[model samples]
Target: MTLSTEGIEPISNAVPKVWHIETVLIMETCPMVLAGIRHLLAQPYFQIKHWLEVSMVVDIPHIIKRHEADLVIMELSGEGESILDGLKIINQYLANWPSASLIVCTALTDDRLLKQLVAMGFMAFISSRIRYRP
Candidate 1:
């Protein structure tokens, strides 16, 4: 950025920017992983509001609506079939909250599934696979 001297003006009419602390929701089938996520997000920055077990609940959209989540992180590791199921469930609910971001973490990295997620307007896709050491 360059400063203009010829057209010098007072910087008094600027509007202040507002920062918002994000509310995050994490849902996973594994208890250990879910607990770990909660502990990690217990930081002073993030507003961790909702933690839902994917297996325990059938109506994911309802839960999401009740929470009105801003950020949703789902782990698709334990249940193989749940990857698609969770995606579909969240995708439908996303219509209600267009500003919400949905991210998925999984060990199985499938190109087709990733493409599908992108098509469905998913925010991010994270692969949790570890490389084999020879």
Candidate 2:
């Protein structure tokens, strides 16, 4: 059966009081990551409001605010682009949206890098090698 938006019920007494949909912005440069997310959250319960591939993290805040996104799934590859740059972007975002949840969908294999990302305000991290949805 096809999932219909009309059949989806809103969670009762949700905090925001706006009956606003919780949207996820898939921000990954990798095609596989994008495809995986598209598959993972394709269930009726989750909504993929938008998918964007940004060249810089500086552009993230505007997109988040404009979309009023509930979560962000980003690709964190410590190669090519320095992790420091990514953290800087997160720091800037925290200045405006401390409560926004950002889940890093990275290929990093080191536990230290994972911990660092968590400290940098990523709500959660899922290895790119994993395909299961939370």
Candidate 3:
């Protein structure tokens, strides 16, 4: 069975109302990748805040308090452990932004992992890899 977006529900918290136009929090270890994504999003349309270190995500609750983003995107670029750690970090802050969306971007094409991510309240899992046909 395919998981539909309509079936996925947003994580709800009893936070105050803040009418924002999509505040984004990007968690990535690569500076270049972070810069590229930041450049893509318009400043007026989105409030983009980034967490640079995957290791530093242990202090995610405090970081979320400072950044306060509605959309949290994680780049799964490292090894299996890092990917697992990233998911853990994202889950911790899910309560920080109840209505926020969490999305994972990776080159991995594992169907089992994709199913797990969806079940974990990850609204989207985007493949970052690009293939060119000759």
Per-candidate local distance difference test: 0.63, 0.67, 0.61
Q: Positional deviation of 23 in candidate 2, in angstroms?
A: 3.0
Query: Which regions of candidate 1 are displaced past 4 Å?
Result: 1-23, 49-57, 76-81, 130-134
Tell me how candidate 1 scores on lDDT. Answer: 0.63
Query: Per-residue lDDT of 1-134 in model 1, one digit per residue for the tens?
Result: 97676766456435323324346666666566566667766665455445454543235566666766677777653444556666666577567776778777666667887777778787887665556799
- Alpha-carbon error at 78 in model 2, in Å? 9.7
lDDT of 2 by residue, 2-114 (tens): 77769566776344433234676666767777787777777565545554556445566678768766777776533267766667767776667789878877776788876
Better of 1 and 3 by lDDT: 1
Regarding TM-score, does 1 or 3 come out ahead?
A: 1
How far residue 84's Cα lies from its native spot in candidate 2, in Å, is: 1.9
TM-score of each: 0.63, 0.66, 0.59
What ordering of candidates by TM-score runs from best to worst? 2, 1, 3
Point out the worst 10-residue segment of candidate 3 by lDDT.
47-56
